[model samples]
Each structure stands twice: as C-alpha cells, then as structure tokens.
Target: MEFVITGDGSNTLYHPEIGEHYHSKHGALQESRHVFLDMGLHHFLAKEETNEVSVLEVGFGTGLNFLLTADDATRRSLQLHYCGIEAYPLPTDVIFATGYHRFVQPATWAAFMQNYAQALTTEVDFAEHIRLKIAHEKLMDFQTDDQFDVLYFDAFAAIHQPEMWSDQSLAHICSYLKPGGIFVTYAITGNLKRSMKALGFTVEKAPGAPGKREMLRATKVG
Candidate 1:
C-alpha cells in the first residue's frame, strides 16, 4: 500500500495488489462525506425520531468513515454504535501516515486515534455518545444478530472484488438492516440496483461525489 494525496487534500491508500485506491482519486474526505455521511447516516437520522443510530461499514480501510461518523455523532449528541468490518486491516504506521488528522479538528484527533488503536483489539467507547467496534473479518464470513439503521457499503469496485457485490452477498448484508434502514454506496451499477430491489430495498440514484457521475441509495422496505 502507498500513500497518495487525493484531490481534496486528503490522503488515501493505493493497493498495488489490486490496483485500486481505497477511495476516489478525486478526493477521499469529500467522497466519504458526500456518499456515506450525508447520504447514509444523516439521511436516515433526519426521518427517524431516535437519538441513537447504528452504522455498519463494509470496508474500514483507513478509518475515514469511522472518524467522520464519530465527529458527526459528537456534534449532534447522538448515540452512535459503529461496527466496521475489514478483511485486510491496515498497519498502524499506514494509518498514521495517511495524516487523517488534517481533515479533523485538532482537539478530537488525539482521542480519535487513541480510540482507533484500542478498537483494533476490542470494542471501545470513544466518547459519551460514540461506541466503535472493528471486526477483522471478511463481509461474506461475518455474522451478527444486531440490526443496524444505516450501512456504509464502501467496498472496492465490483470489478476488483466481484464477490463482495454478488447478489447473495448483498442479500446477506441486507438481512442485517432494520426495516426502513438505509444502504448507501459509491458504485451505481445496474446489477447492483437490481440486486437491491430483488432483496426488497427501495433503491434510488443519488448525485455522486466530485469524481463520480452517480451513486446509489437504498432503503429496506420490509
């Protein structure tokens, strides 16, 4: 993995093995904020009356999504339980070298890093309202009885990891969502939309982030 600076001045990792970047070359933070935080988490919370929100992230990559959600939860004073599943965990040095702190407030960076470190081994309560758990497992092998209100499907493109976007894999992931829960992803392929619809989700196209043309947002109907 190599550190590459994105268009928005955020750092993303380039996986030479797969020839894919962890995030968009256009902008790492920008893409994450637009696709996951805005379209996934906030969109769900806006219509729901509860102060507690649960999020399941498909790829924990550089912990950018986790940090963004943590900051948002803190600002809104919302109770957030975040579960991140990653098959190949990045090294501590790689994470630190990404310089994610530049995108976050200085005061919270220390605590976020500490919580991130502790979260590797076990779940950690990062703040009064934020709880984080990182599971070092592939999405296909992951099993959980817990239901989530939102899912950040930040997996690599289907071309790179086709199995992750398979219909069966999607159905398995959708089974974890509570009724009416939202699922958001950067990829907006025809097959993906069909897969979500077949699994009982109300799928729609959304404006993509800076570098992309379009994205997908789906909600569990039943």
Candidate 2:
C-alpha cells in the first residue's frame, strides 16, 4: 500500500497488485459528501419513500459512506442496513490522519467516527436505525443471494481499476438488486455502460457530482 497527499493535502491511497485506489484527496469526508451523499443519497431521496432502505457499497474505504448513510438514516428516522465489501482496509490511524472531522461537523464527527471504526472491526448495530456489516473479502467472493434497494458503486475509476468494473462484477451486482433497484456510480466510462447493459440493466447517464462532468446510474428492469 502506498499513500500520497493530494494537491490539497487530502490523502490518496493505492494498492498496486489489488488494483485499488482511494482518494482522501477531498478527504474521505469530502469524497463521501460528493460521491455518496450528493450523488447517491440525493438521487435516492428524490425517487423513493420507504421506511427502510438497504444499501450495498462496493468499496468500503475510510468508512465515510457508512457514516454518511447512518447519519441520513438517523435524520430521516429510516431503518438502514448497509452492507459493504473491502478486500483491504486501512488502519484507524490512516483513517484518522486524513482529518475527516475537519470537513464534517466536530460533534457528530466523533460519534460518527467511533461508529465507523467499530463497524469495520466488528459486526454489530451501533444505533437503532443503522446496521453495518463488512464482508472483509473481495466483492467477487460475495454471493448475490440478498438483494438491495440501492447500491453505491463508488469503486475506483475504470481506468484505475478495470477489473473491478468488469462484466462479471456487474452481473453479480445485478443479481443482488431488486427489479427497479438503482445502482449509482461515479465512473462514466463507455465500456462500463456497455458492461452494465450486458448484465440486464437499463442504464442512464445522470448528472455528475463535483469534479466530474457525468456519472452513471443503472436500473434493473422488471
């Protein structure tokens, strides 16, 4: 594992053999805000109204997505089951060193960060509305027996991690999505769109979040 500081002192991580990359570039806090909160949660809220929502995230780096999702669940008083997969997880020091609280509010940041740490290292409910479970394995190793209402496919860009966006993974993901379930992602590569289409998804190009022109959201057709 190698780490580099982005232009703004945010951390970016790379795993050479595993073909994984994470940007703490905006910090994990900012990345989650832009990628998951702004892109995933915003889109989810606009389309659905449910007492409970299931979310599956592809890359569980920094636990930022989980924190944000848990916070939303608490705010909306909605039940949330967040399932994520990560082959390699960073240590707590690496996570804390990124200075997530600097971007997020200080009060909630401590509680959120504590939950985030406990969620990664243990499998238990940290609160009433939110449950976190990490597969602690490659995404490909996980079976698609359980379907989710939404999937946050915030993997590294297709260019940076091609295998993670392959047809096989898309197929696996589709099998885990209910009909009409939505999958949101930050990458807008043409090959990725084709792969999702091949896996029986009705793909759409959605408005991108910050630092990008467009993102992808594919729906499973009933």
Candidate 3:
C-alpha cells in the first residue's frame, strides 16, 4: 500500500493488489466523516437518547473511522464500544505514518496508538469514554455475542473485492446488528440495496461524499 494525497489534501493508501484506494480519492477524511461518522454514528445518536453506543466496522483499513468516532465520543462524553474487522491489518508504522492523528484529539490519537496492537488481542479501554477492539479476521469468520447499534461497511468496492459485497457476506455481517441497528456505507448500488432489503433492512440512499453521487444508510428491521 502506498500513500496518496487525496483531492481534499488528506492522505489515503492505494492498495496496488486490490486496485483500489482505502478511501475515496475525492477526500479520505471527508469520506470517513460523511459516511461513517456523521451518517452512521451521528444519525444513530440523534435517533436515540443514549449515553452509550456500540459500533462495528468492516474494513478498518487505516483506523480513520475509529479515530474520528473516538473524538466525537470524547466531545459528547459518551461511552463508545467500537469493534472493527480487518482481514489484513496494516503495519504499526504505516498507521502512524498516515498523519491521521492530526485529524483527531491529541489524547484520542495517543490512546489509540498506544492500544492499537493490544486491541487486536482483546478489547482495550481506548479512553475514559471509548472501548476498542479489532478482530483480525475475515468477515465470514468473525463472531461476536455483542450486537451493535451501528455498522460501518467500509470494505473495498465490489469491483475490487466482489466476495466482500456478496449477499451471503451481507447476511453474515448484518446478523451482528441489533433489531434497530443502523448500517451505513460509502456505496450504493442496485444489488446492494436489493441485498439489504432482502435481509430486512429499511435502506435509503443518502448524499455521497465529494466523488460519488450517493451512499446508503439502512436500518435493521428484522
């Protein structure tokens, strides 16, 4: 993976093997903020009056989503339980090199860097209000007794990794959600919408980030 400066002056990694970037080339930070943080977490928090929330993220590529969420949790003094699934984790040096720390609170970034490796082994208290864990495994093999209130489907696009967006894969992933759980992603396609509908989710197309025209947000009704 090589770092490339996105259109918005944020950095992202280009995965040569996958033939895709880790985030939208339009803007890495903007994509994460728009899709996962604002659309996913904020929307859930807005709907429910709660002091705590649980989120599950697929394709925790650069930990940008986690960092941003942790920052918001700190701001609101809200307790956040975050879990991410990454089939191939990045190196510690690479994560630190991303310069993503500049985008979040100093404490949030420090705590995350200190606990990132440990989070792979077990959940860690990332901060006073944040708990983090990263399951270093494939989506199909990930199992958790805990159900999440929000899910961030941030995997590479179907063009690059078709298996990750397959209907069976969506079923396995959505099964971890609570009945009223919210699912958000930086993608919206006919097949994806149909898959979510078949899985009992109320899906809607949301405004996309800079490069794309639309994204998706869905609620688990089944």
The number of the candidate with the highest TM-score is: 3
Best by lDDT: 3
Better of 1 and 3 by lDDT: 3
Estimate TM-scores for all models: 0.97, 0.83, 0.98
> What's the ranking of the predictions by lDDT, best on top?
3, 1, 2
| Residues 1-222, model 1: lDDT tens digits | 788989988889999988999999999999999999999998998899988999999999999998888888878889999999998888777777788887776655777767776787788877777888888888889888799999999999999999999998898878899999999999999899999999999999999999788999999997
Sequence-dependent TM-score of model 1? 0.97
Q: What are the per-model numbers of colliding residue pairs?
A: 0, 1, 0
Off by over 4 Å in 3: none
TM-score: model 2 vs. ground truth: 0.83
Score candidate 2 by lDDT: 0.73
lDDT of each structure? 0.89, 0.73, 0.94
What number of backbone clashes does candidate 2 have, counting pairs of residues 3 or more apart or in separate chains? 1
Clashing pairs in 2: 24-27
User: Which has the higher TM-score value, candidate number 1 or candidate number 3?
Assistant: 3
Model 2 poorest 10 in a row by lDDT:
23-32
